[model samples]
Target: MAKRDIPEINAGSMADIAFLLLIFFLVTTTMDKDQAYIRNIPKKVEIKTEIIEVEQRNVLAIKANNQNQLMVRGEIIADPDKISEKIIEFYNTNRNVNDLTNDFPTYTHPTKNEIEANLKAAEKELESFEEQDAGDALIDYAYSKIDEWDKMKRSLKLFGGNDFPLINSQANIRIEVQTRTQYSLFAKIQTEIEEAIFELRDTEAKRIFGESYGVIKTRYISDEEPIDKGKLDLLDVLYPARIIEVTPKN
Candidate 1:
Protein backbone atom coordinates (compact mmCIF):
# COMPACT_ATOMS: atom_id res chain seq x y z
CA MET A 1 0.00 0.00 0.00
CA ALA A 2 1.33 3.44 -0.77
CA LYS A 3 1.97 5.63 2.27
CA ARG A 4 -0.65 8.32 2.78
CA ASP A 5 0.70 11.85 2.10
CA ILE A 6 0.10 14.44 4.89
CA PRO A 7 -1.38 17.79 3.91
CA GLU A 8 0.93 20.81 4.30
CA ILE A 9 0.02 23.19 7.16
CA ASN A 10 -0.74 26.80 6.16
CA ALA A 11 1.64 29.39 7.72
CA GLY A 12 1.12 32.38 5.40
CA SER A 13 -1.30 34.00 7.84
CA MET A 14 0.70 33.15 11.02
CA ALA A 15 2.91 36.22 10.62
CA ASP A 16 -0.15 38.43 10.20
CA ILE A 17 -1.79 37.00 13.34
CA ALA A 18 1.38 37.51 15.36
CA PHE A 19 1.64 41.09 14.09
CA LEU A 20 -1.97 41.77 15.08
CA LEU A 21 -1.38 40.45 18.60
CA LEU A 22 1.73 42.59 18.92
CA ILE A 23 -0.18 45.64 17.83
CA PHE A 24 -3.02 44.94 20.26
CA PHE A 25 -0.62 44.61 23.15
CA LEU A 26 1.32 47.67 22.13
CA VAL A 27 -1.86 49.70 22.06
CA THR A 28 -3.57 48.33 25.19
CA THR A 29 -0.78 47.45 27.60
CA THR A 30 0.29 49.88 30.34
CA MET A 31 3.68 50.26 31.93
CA ASP A 32 4.57 50.98 35.53
CA LYS A 33 6.86 53.91 36.22
CA ASP A 34 9.62 53.80 38.78
CA GLN A 35 8.93 55.84 41.89
CA ALA A 36 11.58 58.42 42.75
CA TYR A 37 12.25 61.56 44.77
CA ILE A 38 13.51 64.51 42.80
CA ARG A 39 16.18 66.59 44.46
CA ASN A 40 18.55 69.33 43.31
CA ILE A 41 22.27 68.90 43.80
CA PRO A 42 24.11 71.84 45.33
CA LYS A 43 26.49 73.73 43.09
CA LYS A 44 30.21 73.38 43.63
CA VAL A 45 31.66 76.22 45.67
CA GLU A 46 34.71 78.04 44.26
CA ILE A 47 35.17 80.60 46.98
CA LYS A 48 35.73 80.08 50.69
CA THR A 49 33.22 81.83 52.92
CA GLU A 50 32.81 82.14 56.65
CA ILE A 51 30.85 79.29 58.21
CA ILE A 52 27.53 80.28 59.75
CA GLU A 53 26.22 78.27 62.67
CA VAL A 54 22.69 76.93 62.46
CA GLU A 55 20.68 77.20 65.64
CA GLN A 56 19.21 74.06 67.14
CA ARG A 57 15.78 75.65 66.85
CA ASN A 58 16.05 75.55 63.05
CA VAL A 59 16.99 71.89 62.77
CA LEU A 60 14.33 69.20 62.45
CA ALA A 61 16.37 66.00 62.50
CA ILE A 62 14.76 62.63 61.74
CA LYS A 63 16.88 59.64 62.63
CA ALA A 64 16.49 55.96 61.85
CA ASN A 65 18.58 53.36 63.62
CA ASN A 66 19.64 49.84 62.67
CA GLN A 67 16.70 48.53 64.67
CA ASN A 68 14.35 50.56 62.46
CA GLN A 69 13.46 52.86 65.31
CA LEU A 70 12.49 56.40 64.39
CA MET A 71 13.21 59.61 66.23
CA VAL A 72 12.08 63.08 65.18
CA ARG A 73 13.38 66.22 66.80
CA GLY A 74 14.84 64.21 69.71
CA GLU A 75 11.44 62.62 70.40
CA ILE A 76 10.86 58.92 69.73
CA ILE A 77 8.12 58.30 67.21
CA ALA A 78 6.16 55.09 67.64
CA ASP A 79 4.10 55.56 64.48
CA PRO A 80 5.72 56.28 61.15
CA ASP A 81 2.54 57.86 59.83
CA LYS A 82 2.83 60.61 62.41
CA ILE A 83 6.04 61.89 60.85
CA SER A 84 4.14 64.22 58.59
CA GLU A 85 2.27 65.79 61.46
CA LYS A 86 5.55 66.52 63.22
CA ILE A 87 6.86 68.17 60.11
CA ILE A 88 3.73 70.29 59.83
CA GLU A 89 4.12 71.37 63.41
CA PHE A 90 7.73 72.24 62.86
CA TYR A 91 6.80 74.58 60.04
CA ASN A 92 3.64 76.05 61.54
CA THR A 93 4.77 76.51 65.12
CA ASN A 94 6.36 79.91 64.75
CA ARG A 95 4.84 80.89 61.42
CA ASN A 96 2.43 83.47 62.85
CA VAL A 97 4.13 84.45 66.07
CA ASN A 98 7.61 83.82 67.40
CA ASP A 99 8.14 82.56 70.92
CA LEU A 100 11.67 82.95 72.15
CA THR A 101 11.33 80.05 74.57
CA ASN A 102 10.26 77.51 71.95
CA ASP A 103 12.64 75.33 69.95
CA PHE A 104 10.87 75.72 66.61
CA PRO A 105 12.19 77.69 63.66
CA THR A 106 11.18 81.35 63.50
CA TYR A 107 9.65 83.21 60.58
CA THR A 108 10.95 86.47 59.09
CA HIS A 109 8.50 88.95 57.59
CA PRO A 110 10.51 91.06 55.18
CA THR A 111 8.81 94.26 54.08
CA LYS A 112 8.52 95.49 50.47
CA ASN A 113 10.98 98.24 51.22
CA GLU A 114 13.55 95.75 52.53
CA ILE A 115 13.18 93.51 49.49
CA GLU A 116 13.52 96.44 47.09
CA ALA A 117 16.63 97.67 48.89
CA ASN A 118 18.16 94.21 48.70
CA LEU A 119 17.29 93.97 45.05
CA LYS A 120 19.05 97.26 44.32
CA ALA A 121 22.10 96.18 46.31
CA ALA A 122 22.27 92.87 44.50
CA GLU A 123 22.06 94.56 41.08
CA LYS A 124 24.74 97.06 42.06
CA GLU A 125 26.99 94.23 43.25
CA LEU A 126 26.48 92.39 39.98
CA GLU A 127 27.40 95.54 37.98
CA SER A 128 30.53 96.07 40.11
CA PHE A 129 31.64 92.49 39.52
CA GLU A 130 31.13 92.89 35.78
CA GLU A 131 33.21 96.11 35.71
CA GLN A 132 36.06 94.49 37.65
CA ASP A 133 36.04 91.45 35.38
CA ALA A 134 35.43 89.19 38.38
CA GLY A 135 35.82 85.43 38.01
CA ASP A 136 32.94 83.53 36.45
CA ALA A 137 32.02 81.98 39.80
CA LEU A 138 31.82 85.34 41.56
CA ILE A 139 29.85 86.88 38.74
CA ASP A 140 27.49 83.96 38.75
CA TYR A 141 27.11 84.26 42.50
CA ALA A 142 26.20 87.92 42.12
CA TYR A 143 23.69 87.11 39.44
CA SER A 144 22.16 84.43 41.65
CA LYS A 145 21.76 86.94 44.47
CA ILE A 146 20.06 89.32 42.11
CA ASP A 147 17.76 86.61 40.89
CA GLU A 148 17.02 85.61 44.47
CA TRP A 149 15.96 89.15 45.31
CA ASP A 150 13.93 89.42 42.16
CA LYS A 151 12.13 86.21 43.01
CA MET A 152 11.44 87.54 46.47
CA LYS A 153 9.95 90.67 44.95
CA ARG A 154 7.66 88.66 42.73
CA SER A 155 6.76 86.35 45.58
CA LEU A 156 5.86 89.32 47.78
CA LYS A 157 3.68 90.86 45.11
CA LEU A 158 1.87 87.60 44.58
CA PHE A 159 1.45 87.20 48.31
CA GLY A 160 -0.82 90.30 48.36
CA GLY A 161 0.04 90.95 51.97
CA ASN A 162 1.93 93.55 53.92
CA ASP A 163 5.00 91.36 54.42
CA PHE A 164 6.52 88.25 52.89
CA PRO A 165 6.81 85.58 55.53
CA LEU A 166 9.96 83.48 55.16
CA ILE A 167 11.46 80.76 57.25
CA ASN A 168 15.01 81.03 58.48
CA SER A 169 17.62 80.44 55.77
CA GLN A 170 19.42 77.91 57.96
CA ALA A 171 16.27 75.95 58.77
CA ASN A 172 16.28 72.40 57.40
CA ILE A 173 14.78 68.93 57.70
CA ARG A 174 17.60 66.40 58.10
CA ILE A 175 17.21 62.66 57.56
CA GLU A 176 19.82 60.34 59.05
CA VAL A 177 19.72 56.59 58.73
CA GLN A 178 21.97 53.81 59.91
CA THR A 179 23.70 51.40 57.53
CA ARG A 180 21.49 48.52 58.58
CA THR A 181 18.27 50.49 58.23
CA GLN A 182 15.84 49.05 55.73
CA TYR A 183 15.26 50.85 52.45
CA SER A 184 11.50 50.67 52.98
CA LEU A 185 11.77 52.72 56.16
CA PHE A 186 13.97 55.28 54.46
CA ALA A 187 11.47 55.64 51.65
CA LYS A 188 8.67 55.97 54.19
CA ILE A 189 10.52 58.82 55.83
CA GLN A 190 10.82 60.61 52.54
CA THR A 191 7.17 60.05 51.71
CA GLU A 192 6.01 61.43 55.02
CA ILE A 193 8.10 64.55 54.54
CA GLU A 194 6.73 64.97 51.06
CA GLU A 195 3.21 64.62 52.36
CA ALA A 196 3.72 67.33 54.94
CA ILE A 197 5.20 69.76 52.47
CA PHE A 198 2.43 69.06 50.00
CA GLU A 199 -0.22 69.76 52.60
CA LEU A 200 1.37 73.07 53.54
CA ARG A 201 1.70 74.17 49.92
CA ASP A 202 -1.75 72.95 48.99
CA THR A 203 -3.34 74.90 51.81
CA GLU A 204 -1.49 78.05 50.89
CA ALA A 205 -2.25 77.64 47.20
CA LYS A 206 -5.97 77.35 47.84
CA ARG A 207 -5.89 80.33 50.16
CA ILE A 208 -4.07 82.53 47.66
CA PHE A 209 -5.08 81.26 44.21
CA GLY A 210 -8.41 79.56 44.91
CA GLU A 211 -6.89 76.36 43.51
CA SER A 212 -5.22 73.33 44.94
CA TYR A 213 -1.46 72.96 44.81
CA GLY A 214 -1.77 69.62 43.05
CA VAL A 215 -3.92 71.20 40.35
CA ILE A 216 -1.46 74.02 39.75
CA LYS A 217 1.47 71.60 39.75
CA THR A 218 -0.23 69.25 37.30
CA ARG A 219 -1.17 72.12 35.02
CA TYR A 220 2.32 73.53 35.15
CA ILE A 221 3.83 70.16 34.33
CA SER A 222 1.57 69.79 31.34
CA ASP A 223 1.56 73.33 29.91
CA GLU A 224 4.37 75.23 31.64
CA GLU A 225 2.12 78.27 31.94
CA PRO A 226 3.74 81.40 33.35
CA ILE A 227 0.80 82.03 35.67
CA ASP A 228 1.10 78.61 37.22
CA LYS A 229 4.86 79.06 37.45
CA GLY A 230 4.44 82.30 39.38
CA LYS A 231 1.92 80.69 41.71
CA LEU A 232 4.31 77.81 42.38
CA ASP A 233 7.13 80.23 43.02
CA LEU A 234 5.06 82.09 45.55
CA LEU A 235 4.07 78.88 47.33
CA ASP A 236 7.68 77.76 47.39
CA VAL A 237 8.78 80.99 48.98
CA LEU A 238 6.14 80.57 51.65
CA TYR A 239 6.87 76.91 52.40
CA PRO A 240 10.30 75.86 51.25
CA ALA A 241 11.18 72.20 51.65
CA ARG A 242 14.78 72.33 52.75
CA ILE A 243 15.46 68.64 53.18
CA ILE A 244 18.87 67.12 53.78
CA GLU A 245 19.23 63.38 53.33
CA VAL A 246 22.39 62.11 54.95
CA THR A 247 24.22 59.07 53.67
CA PRO A 248 23.89 56.02 55.87
CA LYS A 249 26.88 55.63 58.13
CA ASN A 250 28.51 52.24 58.39
Candidate 2:
Protein backbone atom coordinates (compact mmCIF):
# COMPACT_ATOMS: atom_id res chain seq x y z
CA MET A 1 0.00 0.00 0.00
CA ALA A 2 3.07 2.34 -0.49
CA LYS A 3 2.07 3.36 -4.10
CA ARG A 4 1.06 6.83 -2.88
CA ASP A 5 4.69 8.15 -2.97
CA ILE A 6 5.63 6.92 -6.55
CA PRO A 7 7.83 9.35 -8.54
CA GLU A 8 6.51 10.66 -11.98
CA ILE A 9 8.61 9.59 -15.05
CA ASN A 10 10.13 12.45 -17.19
CA ALA A 11 8.94 12.53 -20.86
CA GLY A 12 10.49 15.92 -21.87
CA SER A 13 13.50 14.57 -23.90
CA MET A 14 11.65 11.68 -25.66
CA ALA A 15 10.63 13.85 -28.63
CA ASP A 16 14.12 15.29 -28.89
CA ILE A 17 15.67 11.78 -28.94
CA ALA A 18 13.19 10.70 -31.71
CA PHE A 19 13.97 13.85 -33.72
CA LEU A 20 17.72 13.11 -33.52
CA LEU A 21 17.20 9.48 -34.64
CA LEU A 22 15.06 10.63 -37.56
CA ILE A 23 17.71 13.11 -38.65
CA PHE A 24 20.44 10.45 -38.37
CA PHE A 25 18.52 7.95 -40.54
CA LEU A 26 17.66 10.65 -43.07
CA VAL A 27 21.30 11.61 -43.48
CA THR A 28 22.54 8.00 -43.67
CA THR A 29 20.00 6.48 -46.09
CA THR A 30 20.56 6.86 -49.87
CA MET A 31 17.22 7.37 -51.60
CA ASP A 32 18.10 8.44 -55.14
CA LYS A 33 19.02 5.69 -57.61
CA ASP A 34 21.06 6.10 -60.77
CA GLN A 35 19.13 7.28 -63.84
CA ALA A 36 18.62 4.62 -66.55
CA TYR A 37 19.07 6.87 -69.56
CA ILE A 38 22.11 9.10 -70.15
CA ARG A 39 20.36 12.43 -70.44
CA ASN A 40 22.30 14.88 -72.69
CA ILE A 41 21.00 18.08 -71.13
CA PRO A 42 21.65 21.23 -73.16
CA LYS A 43 22.99 24.42 -71.68
CA LYS A 44 20.87 27.59 -71.73
CA VAL A 45 22.23 29.77 -74.52
CA GLU A 46 20.86 33.12 -75.69
CA ILE A 47 20.73 32.78 -79.47
CA LYS A 48 19.82 35.32 -82.17
CA THR A 49 16.04 35.64 -82.52
CA GLU A 50 15.93 34.41 -86.10
CA ILE A 51 13.34 32.01 -87.47
CA ILE A 52 15.15 29.08 -89.11
CA GLU A 53 12.92 26.79 -91.14
CA VAL A 54 13.26 22.99 -91.13
CA GLU A 55 11.85 20.98 -94.00
CA GLN A 56 9.13 18.44 -93.18
CA ARG A 57 10.86 15.81 -95.34
CA ASN A 58 14.04 16.06 -93.27
CA VAL A 59 12.21 15.30 -90.01
CA LEU A 60 11.58 11.66 -89.01
CA ALA A 61 8.44 12.07 -86.92
CA ILE A 62 7.42 9.52 -84.25
CA LYS A 63 4.26 9.66 -82.15
CA ALA A 64 3.08 7.64 -79.13
CA ASN A 65 -0.64 8.00 -78.35
CA ASN A 66 -2.46 7.62 -74.99
CA GLN A 67 -3.19 3.96 -75.73
CA ASN A 68 0.59 3.38 -76.14
CA GLN A 69 0.13 2.93 -79.83
CA LEU A 70 3.33 3.88 -81.70
CA MET A 71 3.33 5.69 -85.01
CA VAL A 72 6.22 6.62 -87.30
CA ARG A 73 5.22 9.29 -89.76
CA GLY A 74 1.48 8.55 -90.35
CA GLU A 75 1.75 4.75 -90.28
CA ILE A 76 1.01 2.85 -87.04
CA ILE A 77 3.61 0.33 -85.80
CA ALA A 78 2.18 -2.75 -84.04
CA ASP A 79 5.37 -4.45 -82.81
CA PRO A 80 7.85 -2.61 -80.60
CA ASP A 81 10.81 -4.75 -81.82
CA LYS A 82 10.46 -3.41 -85.36
CA ILE A 83 10.46 0.24 -84.32
CA SER A 84 14.26 0.60 -84.51
CA GLU A 85 14.52 -0.96 -87.95
CA LYS A 86 11.84 1.37 -89.17
CA ILE A 87 13.73 4.31 -87.72
CA ILE A 88 16.83 3.17 -89.60
CA GLU A 89 14.89 2.96 -92.86
CA PHE A 90 13.40 6.38 -92.28
CA TYR A 91 16.81 7.82 -91.45
CA ASN A 92 18.48 6.24 -94.47
CA THR A 93 15.78 7.10 -97.00
CA ASN A 94 17.16 9.26 -99.79
CA ARG A 95 14.65 10.14 -102.50
CA ASN A 96 15.92 13.69 -103.00
CA VAL A 97 18.34 16.14 -101.37
CA ASN A 98 15.61 17.37 -98.98
CA ASP A 99 14.67 13.78 -98.03
CA LEU A 100 18.23 12.42 -97.83
CA THR A 101 19.36 10.07 -95.06
CA ASN A 102 22.74 8.67 -93.89
CA ASP A 103 23.95 6.68 -96.87
CA PHE A 104 26.50 4.42 -95.18
CA PRO A 105 28.27 1.49 -96.90
CA THR A 106 29.92 3.07 -99.90
CA TYR A 107 33.42 2.23 -101.20
CA THR A 108 34.72 2.32 -97.58
CA HIS A 109 34.71 -0.65 -95.20
CA PRO A 110 31.19 -0.02 -93.86
CA THR A 111 29.91 -3.60 -93.70
CA LYS A 112 30.48 -5.70 -90.57
CA ASN A 113 31.84 -8.67 -92.53
CA GLU A 114 34.21 -6.40 -94.43
CA ILE A 115 35.56 -4.76 -91.29
CA GLU A 116 35.86 -8.08 -89.44
CA ALA A 117 37.81 -9.62 -92.28
CA ASN A 118 40.23 -6.70 -92.37
CA LEU A 119 40.78 -6.83 -88.58
CA LYS A 120 41.36 -10.58 -88.61
CA ALA A 121 43.89 -10.21 -91.39
CA ALA A 122 45.67 -7.44 -89.53
CA GLU A 123 45.68 -9.47 -86.32
CA LYS A 124 47.15 -12.47 -88.15
CA GLU A 125 49.80 -10.26 -89.69
CA LEU A 126 50.59 -8.82 -86.28
CA GLU A 127 51.02 -12.30 -84.83
CA SER A 128 53.35 -13.30 -87.69
CA PHE A 129 55.36 -10.11 -87.22
CA GLU A 130 55.68 -10.81 -83.51
CA GLU A 131 57.05 -14.31 -84.25
CA GLN A 132 59.62 -12.88 -86.72
CA ASP A 133 60.83 -10.27 -84.18
CA ALA A 134 59.84 -7.16 -86.16
CA GLY A 135 60.28 -5.15 -82.91
CA ASP A 136 58.57 -1.69 -82.66
CA ALA A 137 57.95 -1.56 -86.39
CA LEU A 138 55.45 -4.44 -86.29
CA ILE A 139 53.79 -3.27 -83.07
CA ASP A 140 53.40 0.28 -84.32
CA TYR A 141 52.12 -0.93 -87.68
CA ALA A 142 49.49 -3.23 -86.12
CA TYR A 143 48.26 -0.52 -83.73
CA SER A 144 48.07 2.03 -86.53
CA LYS A 145 46.22 -0.44 -88.74
CA ILE A 146 43.57 -1.12 -86.10
CA ASP A 147 43.43 2.56 -85.19
CA GLU A 148 42.83 3.60 -88.79
CA TRP A 149 40.08 1.02 -89.24
CA ASP A 150 38.47 2.07 -85.98
CA LYS A 151 38.60 5.71 -86.99
CA MET A 152 37.07 4.94 -90.35
CA LYS A 153 34.22 3.14 -88.64
CA ARG A 154 33.64 5.60 -85.75
CA SER A 155 33.67 9.30 -86.67
CA LEU A 156 33.03 12.36 -84.50
CA LYS A 157 31.90 14.85 -87.14
CA LEU A 158 29.09 13.94 -89.48
CA PHE A 159 30.15 13.38 -93.08
CA GLY A 160 28.98 15.98 -95.51
CA GLY A 161 29.28 15.73 -99.30
CA ASN A 162 32.78 17.23 -99.08
CA ASP A 163 33.69 15.12 -96.06
CA PHE A 164 33.28 11.34 -96.05
CA PRO A 165 30.25 9.70 -97.68
CA LEU A 166 27.76 10.66 -94.89
CA ILE A 167 24.95 13.13 -95.49
CA ASN A 168 23.97 16.17 -93.36
CA SER A 169 24.73 16.17 -89.61
CA GLN A 170 21.66 18.14 -88.53
CA ALA A 171 19.15 16.88 -85.98
CA ASN A 172 16.54 14.94 -87.98
CA ILE A 173 14.74 12.64 -85.54
CA ARG A 174 11.75 13.95 -83.54
CA ILE A 175 9.68 12.05 -80.94
CA GLU A 176 6.25 13.14 -79.65
CA VAL A 177 4.08 11.36 -77.09
CA GLN A 178 0.55 12.02 -75.91
CA THR A 179 0.04 13.56 -72.43
CA ARG A 180 -1.89 10.58 -70.99
CA THR A 181 0.57 7.94 -72.24
CA GLN A 182 2.26 5.88 -69.55
CA TYR A 183 5.88 6.87 -68.98
CA SER A 184 6.89 3.22 -69.14
CA LEU A 185 5.40 2.80 -72.59
CA PHE A 186 6.98 6.01 -73.85
CA ALA A 187 10.34 5.02 -72.36
CA LYS A 188 10.20 1.60 -74.01
CA ILE A 189 9.45 3.09 -77.42
CA GLN A 190 12.19 5.67 -77.02
CA THR A 191 14.64 2.94 -75.99
CA GLU A 192 13.85 0.84 -79.04
CA ILE A 193 14.39 3.80 -81.36
CA GLU A 194 17.73 4.44 -79.71
CA GLU A 195 18.60 0.75 -79.97
CA ALA A 196 18.00 0.91 -83.70
CA ILE A 197 20.48 3.76 -84.03
CA PHE A 198 22.79 1.90 -81.68
CA GLU A 199 22.48 -1.27 -83.74
CA LEU A 200 23.80 0.46 -86.84
CA ARG A 201 26.70 1.97 -84.92
CA ASP A 202 27.33 -1.19 -82.94
CA THR A 203 27.43 -3.31 -86.03
CA GLU A 204 30.05 -1.00 -87.46
CA ALA A 205 32.00 -1.12 -84.18
CA LYS A 206 31.87 -4.89 -83.98
CA ARG A 207 33.27 -5.09 -87.47
CA ILE A 208 35.94 -2.44 -86.95
CA PHE A 209 37.10 -2.95 -83.33
CA GLY A 210 35.54 -6.29 -82.30
CA GLU A 211 33.71 -4.74 -79.35
CA SER A 212 30.08 -4.01 -78.45
CA TYR A 213 28.72 -0.47 -78.49
CA GLY A 214 28.32 -0.27 -74.69
CA VAL A 215 31.97 -1.11 -73.95
CA ILE A 216 33.32 1.78 -76.02
CA LYS A 217 30.76 4.44 -75.08
CA THR A 218 32.30 7.54 -73.43
CA ARG A 219 29.42 7.92 -70.97
CA TYR A 220 29.53 4.32 -69.70
CA ILE A 221 33.32 4.03 -70.10
CA SER A 222 35.58 6.71 -68.64
CA ASP A 223 38.53 8.58 -70.17
CA GLU A 224 40.74 7.46 -67.24
CA GLU A 225 39.83 3.88 -68.07
CA PRO A 226 41.81 2.35 -70.93
CA ILE A 227 39.23 2.50 -73.77
CA ASP A 228 39.83 2.99 -77.45
CA LYS A 229 38.84 6.65 -77.96
CA GLY A 230 39.11 6.09 -81.68
CA LYS A 231 36.32 3.53 -81.46
CA LEU A 232 34.11 5.80 -79.34
CA ASP A 233 34.65 8.73 -81.66
CA LEU A 234 33.76 6.53 -84.63
CA LEU A 235 30.57 5.33 -82.93
CA ASP A 236 29.51 8.93 -82.29
CA VAL A 237 29.98 9.74 -85.95
CA LEU A 238 28.24 6.56 -87.09
CA TYR A 239 25.28 6.70 -84.66
CA PRO A 240 24.57 10.02 -82.98
CA ALA A 241 21.42 9.73 -80.83
CA ARG A 242 20.19 13.17 -81.76
CA ILE A 243 16.52 12.63 -80.94
CA ILE A 244 14.51 15.69 -79.91
CA GLU A 245 11.53 15.02 -77.60
CA VAL A 246 8.71 17.56 -77.76
CA THR A 247 6.07 18.24 -75.08
CA PRO A 248 3.55 15.39 -74.91
CA LYS A 249 0.72 16.35 -77.26
CA ASN A 250 -2.41 14.42 -78.19
Any idea what lDDT model 1 has?
0.92
List the global CA lDDT of all models: 0.92, 0.66
TM-score of each: 0.86, 0.55
List model 1 lDDT by residue over 1-250, tens digit each: 9999999999999999999999999999879878798887677686789988889999999999999999999999999999999999999999999888999999999999999999999999989999999989989889889888898899999888779779988899999999999999999999999999999999998888899999999999999999889999999888999988888766
Q: How close is candidate 1 to the true structure, as a TM-score?
A: 0.86
Candidate 1 at 93: error in angstroms? 0.9
Task: For residue 220, give model 1's deviation from the true position in Å.
Answer: 0.8
Per-residue lDDT tens digits for candidate 2, residues 214-242, read 77785445564424665566566555567
State which candidate has the highest lDDT. Answer: 1
In candidate 2, which residue pairs get closer than 3 Å at backbone N, Cα or C atoms, i.e. clash?
154-234, 155-234
Residue 169, model 1: Cα distance from true site in angstroms: 1.6
Give the deviation of candidate 2 from the true structure as CA RMSD: 14.9
lDDT value for candidate 2? 0.66
